[model samples]
Target chain A: MINIEDYAERQMRRRGMEITYARMLPVVVRRIADNNGQVLVNSMEFDAYNQYWYLVNAYELPVGTRITSDTHVTLLETHTNDTMEEFSGKIKIELPASFTGNVCQALFYQVLVK
Target chain B: MTGSTRVIHHPIQLIVRQPLTPVNIYTVLPGHIRRVVGVKVVHSVGVHLMSADTYLPAIGYLSLEFNNRSYHMGHVDVSFDNRAEASDAYLDTEIDIIPGSLLSGHYENKVFTGTDYQRADGTITDKWSNYIVTIYLKALSDD
Candidate 1:
């Protein structure tokens, strides 16, 4: 094998950057959806990772009616970068009686590493 | 008689890919020095903001994860262009991300706060409004 160092160097020069050492980590956010249980869940997990994950760029938005409840939305840390930093969180929303569809919703993160 | 063997060297090439998630309009801003907020993204490419109304600054950092396995990449500053009447064919614009802020294999989730983005009263707001940017990653991967 030629060696990864040389490869990394070539990668740098290609982009007009000085030669340096580091691997490219590609994390993909594939999907985002809303689920039941009043929890906005994401399937952003792997076997080597943790059941819990980090929630970034997260917030709450009422779909139709203004929600009012003490069950405020919370972001629980279930995992860290221990396994490349996974992200997972829940969204709790209290909707009005006129609201027809889901009371709360969320987005899913699907990361692929090559 | 033995046949002569040929030694071929495969030159390295940078392969680019779109982000796993789609950027929404909220993440895009319309200003000269804008800091992006509320978008869960790690990297962007070629200053392409995926819209005719937005532009990525000349310098910026997209922090999604850390490669050390013991830490994470923090936030950096950049201005996003969210001009409603911004011209087209701006595919050449590029953001300047600091080399020291990231490492190989560090995956970032949310892009928060721009250093220069402060309210008229001088307060920082880590939020973007309707910025649908296309983030591209450059890496060496199997074809």
Candidate 2:
């Protein structure tokens, strides 16, 4: 529901960097079993000179027979600082047994700092 | 030139909210939101000082306060990498948001670097910038 300009303006004032435009990236898990099915969900890396962060939100859900269940998003530094002159890492989503189908999804923002 | 340096401070208290149309409202779920199941969240942050001390960047800290619990993610430092090279720095490890009760989050992006030193002559003192962070909450109601 957040707009583009307002989002950008806030980052500009708060982060000191100006965001021309921003969009959302969906993080969804499909066909997950009811058991602890640890799946390698998503991973990303970037090479930019600026600083940035991704804002992720649950869109679909962690719902099932109960109100909500347990899920995990694992963060790993795939590469070390000496590997590349870059700051980056990898992420893997752990779909809970309660989460089935593609009903569980999240929205995230990919910010590019200049 | 003497120095192109000024302390950077971004004490940003952001509340990730869902936008109605053009205005992004605060992250407070409506009655209709709880009617459905629940949603989950996952994310991270990283920075690279490809040009070394010239354009250094760091993440002072990132935190998430939800379910009456406060989780401090981690920090980012990539200032020692060579210019035009990539220095890998894992800022945030992981953030898992479960559904049910409405949730709230707070991310602190405190950076320290010389903004104009590169343009001025790439020779400035090292200092910490104001904290610039982005925080988002339950945005399922938007879609």
Candidate 3:
């Protein structure tokens, strides 16, 4: 298994730093669409003091919903899709059209580098 | 290097039969791999079918969990367009696996409906096809 703490330690070590502590943070977003239209979830921003955030994984609940970053780029592109939903910078999710009211959810996993 | 470690490939095959539901599969790692270095997926060609003048790949999400860890690896597309047939399609990873660890793979197949193919006499309905997918794990091992 890939240890999140070990992965964060290596990420910091590559930049000539030592990780004092590491943690995994879960960001969950949910939205309900009133009609048969697409729901657009805005980009989520992460800000913390003395800690760096790295996107390690992401998931769409109910699955098969399109998740994107930077307006157009699909978060999981090509074969890398099987390994990790690795993305840098920003994150957003566009839920598919649904009849009646439906609830859509997106989950992102990030590692805190401190 | 210390124990005659070398690279190996472990392949797991899955058959998707239903739509709109998540199919779960798992495998126990051989008693050798110390670190999994890469991952690649091979999608069966039949997954991408031409229906009602539309060539659509069956959209699906793939999630991976190793050793029952709290953190998951994904919810990524495993459609036909994302197969690892090309040279650059291999996914590099740094997952360390204990010998005999359990690795699970989950897939959710989505339904895609296309327009009906209209002809002079009758119209043909579009249908989704069931297919197979193989996931390859490249790892460093000491046998």
A2-110 per-residue lDDT for model 2 (tens digits)? 5544554564555355665455556554453335755433222323223333434433334211111111112112221211011113333444443435445544455
**True lDDT of residue A13, candidate 1:** 52
CAPRI level of candidate 3: incorrect
Residue by residue across B79-113, what tens digits does model 2's lDDT show?
Answer: 32234555332233233333333333323223333
Residue A26 CA error for candidate 1 (Å)?
29
lDDT score for candidate 1 against the true structure: 0.28
User: Model 1 segments beyond 4 Å from truth?
Assistant: A1-85, A88-100, A104-114, B1-61, B78-143
In angstroms, give how far residue B37 of model 3 lies from its true place: 0.3
Docking class of 1: incorrect
Task: For model 1, state the Cα shift of residue A73 in Å.
Answer: 17
Winner by lDDT: 3
Clashing pairs for model 3 are none
lDDT by residue for model 1 (B49-135), tens: 332436554233333332222122333333355566543321222232232323222121123333333343324344323233233
